[model samples]
Target: MSQSHTAVTPSVNKVVLAYSGGLDTSAIVPWLRETYDCEVIAFVADVGQGDEELEGIEAKALKSGASACYIVDLKDKFVNELIAPAMQAGCIYEEQYLLGTALARPVIAEAQVQVALEVGADAVCHGCTGKGNDQVRFESTFAALAPHLTVIAPWREWDMRSRQDLLNYLAERNIKTTASATKIYSRDANLWHISHEGGELEDPWNAPTDQVWTLSVSPQQAPDTTEVVDLTFDAGILTHVNGSAMTQTEALVALNSLGAAHGVGRIDIVENRLVGMKSRGCYETPGGAIWYQGLRGLEELVHDRPCQRLRHQLGQQLADVLYDGQWFTPVREALLAAVAVLAQKLTGTVRLGLYKGNITVLGRKSPFTLYSEAFATFEEDEVYQQKDAAGFIRLFSLSSRIRALKQGGLQ
Candidate 1:
């Protein structure tokens, strides 16, 4: 209903859109052309979703009445700029999976805004539903980077009540779409993880059937044998796996392969959406589990307990902020600044053994490690003053002792 309200009418010539070639966006292209009488350009960001999703997308845009379609490959930039820093903070949404959708959105929206500027478009558009988090995500980036450009959200304007309504609207216009309401599931996928929602996933108690997953196989169906891989990090950037150097995209691909075979990551949770809705979704982050654990293990070797605690606390808050589409805010920048300081000496090698539904750290080593085997050994150690602990404990428990004594005297 909010989508029905007219945005401040502005003088506009052309609009650039973040197009996905999905049911919603497929309809949006024609709608924009008809309503505004302006040229429409489609912009798609390739963030490692898949070739199948990208194949023939340009033609689809043109058929839907676009002036031009620009598909930008942002895989390398995604992993290096957005994902790498988030990984360093150990950012995980709801303690389940890495923030895959949360991570990709800002970059995608940024690219769309860039295309708008490049094409000299006065307005931007997206097909995100008014109720969903994505509308907020795309619009927030637009507000931050391109405040002058007006945003056209077609989902808010159109009278399509449901997916069926949208399908019919497209059908009447002779626009082709493969999406169907019978599918019962809406999914978003990238290299980091895949998320599933709708149908039974809408109910909190309904168990997700194996059919919902695509990236990682079910743990029950995973291979019986365990697999081991080595990961090396320098100054918080993941540099190598098994002594082989790789680009960020390549390394994630390699790890995803290993993690998928062993069923290392799968999670179902009811998450708080940015729009004040609680939505139930299943997410699979196989390779991400290994990478997160590997980085955490290395951080343990370098940081003290308090620093690690601070990092984890910051990570939890950052995950929430990132999930809420607040990445453009100063809070996110400050969080990243703190993470950078914490990650300065996070240089290490971590060996992980992947087995059915498990990613275990097999071994860990670091040149800048603060762990000392001698000080930590159970066998009588020279570094620790055992007798001094008696005095320390007495001091630590002094308040408790005084409270008990006073209470007893009062009685």
Candidate 2:
């Protein structure tokens, strides 16, 4: 294997670790201290995974031999800064994934870097495996933000391979972890969505059982009645849901509750990973689905064909950039710049109906809409000249007509 080389010094006196209070990360603290003879400071980012995942996380990190722990609440930043702009741009990877895991990484890594700088640590660490995209995402952000800081990825360097091995390592050191060999699925969760992999998901032929899902119910189990919610957007920023003003985070939480009851946002896809491998994953983005539909519906009313095409192209490019962990690059900033200009006209309200894993555009209304009732109506309208379409169609098809005539004469 190639060496995990960085330009920093070989001797690291202190390091900051991205801790999840899980089996691998818990073991990593003691391993780092023992191997490097350094003080370990744990950094935890709360991106609204849940109260259960975060409960007593600081104490858990301390128990794992971390000298100190800093748990930063990145929930607001996650929704507002990362998710809101992506939603406005309508970014969905492979036409299905709402980028739940992809969107969370940069913000989390940014916080991790901040903690490292604040404590004057010479190194930063993460527990991501070598096979996953997260390793790229975490390391890329770290490289962009703090190049001088050493990166310690224990999974790439350590001898421990299995969950039982990590558990045994922790046990031997008198460290405790709540993980077991019986754990079925590998999962990542944030405020936007939850992703499931490993377990039965390794094989694309196998379908996910109810146990694979933690956030939403099965489509069959969803309520029979349809539910409608009105979303209001100001300059492409979501401001209210169902007539109540809300922040970006509040709107998503409320929508998730409504959509989960209707089994709205669940997708199973075999996507191409950035590491040049295909992996199967099941993602649940209940609220994201509703927001995506609402934004697109509102876009239709406000954007003309050329403007709409530009927005669609921007979405595709943004998805690729985000999935590849290139968020801090100039390419992403350019895409967002266009999205910002387009969003100035994207002020509207859309009512969406959710039922049995389906989202329907009930209605759309916008002050900036280019759709004029007088021009579109079948009834005679004074504003539009019906005779003008004759000349327009002739000019539109002039090239085709000329080509056909010349070929006919030649034949």
Candidate 3:
């Protein structure tokens, strides 16, 4: 089925593939075995995409010609290790994307590499298309963690140009595939968010219809009543929701339900893909939006102006690094360390209101709050002297005054 122009050479005996039980990956299993003449092992990471996606995935993989299939549960690890740290640093790519798909790539790649080693596979493979960012993300991880293992990207070698080509190839080979040429959207989902692409979304001017959305209702259809939630964070980690202590995964699931009920987070943007193309995508990140707002509220209460400025800089840098698949590098580690220091005092509780795609901070309190009521009072108070501001203002503007005088602009 593969139309590789070059002469076929067997480079490896076995390969561990990053499989998702999807059409591309299902076709990839048989293609790898037939082309490479090697054993194929499938690796699946469950980052809480939901039970429907994972159910019978291993069986499907085995039936697709894989010698073995590994389905690892990465939900808690994903939320705690990847999602939590990114949230703390406020790492949103291009000021809009929550880095949901970007963040999950490295975690999935790392686990895939581990499975490859455990199974004694001589190489690793992925189902990512040549034009997408996941290819870079997966290969970069392979280059960092295990350079000795050969990396096989089938899409680069295969001549399949479209979804139809893949389906036809599989059909010719008598391999069953659930995907069809009429599929409207390409979707990727995890615990953090769901990303939708293709179909009407390819044209940026086209508005997404109701069928395009899965996680949340339309803002117009959202309930009229406002919902309030209490979130508690300790040392940059979300610890509780609405007076109940919970694990990182539990809290996210709870917040996702609440936020989705009110249509909290939905973004549609044309993003710059790592492959030098612009792609249109819509994302639903309900729980993540609420968490970001709550943490920002606490940050305002605790962090000073200088600290906040530096944190903002760190966030931008972290966003780029994470998006570029440089998570395993020293620069990412350094940035995370800096963010950790800034988040040391970010412990507090924040009450937030959710209504029709809006998140508003109702109240916030922190033990390390820098707000001083006496110094900030509008009425006359013993702690403040009104006349002191005259001298302070004069000194602050002295450079401007001197410049004006030298230019003969002031009498």
Candidate number of the best TM-score: 3
Per-residue accuracy of model 3 over 1-411 as CA lDDT, tens digit each = 546736465588999999998889999998888889999999999999999989888898998899999999999989998899898988888888998899898899999999988889999999888788888888999999999999888888878888888888888878787789999999999999999999899889999988889999878889998899999999999999999999989999999999889998899989999889999999999999999989988999999999988888898898888888888999999999999998889898999999999999999999999999989989778998999999999999999989898887735
TM-score of each: 0.95, 0.96, 0.98
Which of 1 and 3 is ahead in lDDT? 3
Query: What lDDT does model 1 reach?
Result: 0.87
Candidate 1 residue spans exceeding 4 A from truth? 1-10, 409-411
What ranges in model 2 sit over 4 Å off?
Answer: 1-9, 409-411
Residues 46-145 of candidate 2 have per-residue lDDT tens digits of: 9999999899989998988899999899999999889988988989898999999999999999999999999999999999999989899999999999
The residue ranges of model 3 lying beyond 4 angstroms of the native Cα positions read: 5-10
Clash pairs (backbone) in predicted model 3:
none
Candidate 1: residue 38 Cα off by (Å): 1.4
Candidate 1 residue lDDT tens string, 1-411: 112436655566999988889988888887887778789999999998999999999999999999999999998988898888888999988777588888999999999999999999999998888888999998999999999999888777767778888788788889998888787888998878888998888778889987888898777888888888899999889999999999878999998888888887788888878788888888888878888999998998999989999999889988887888888999999999999999998898999888888988888999989999898899999999888999999999999899899886445
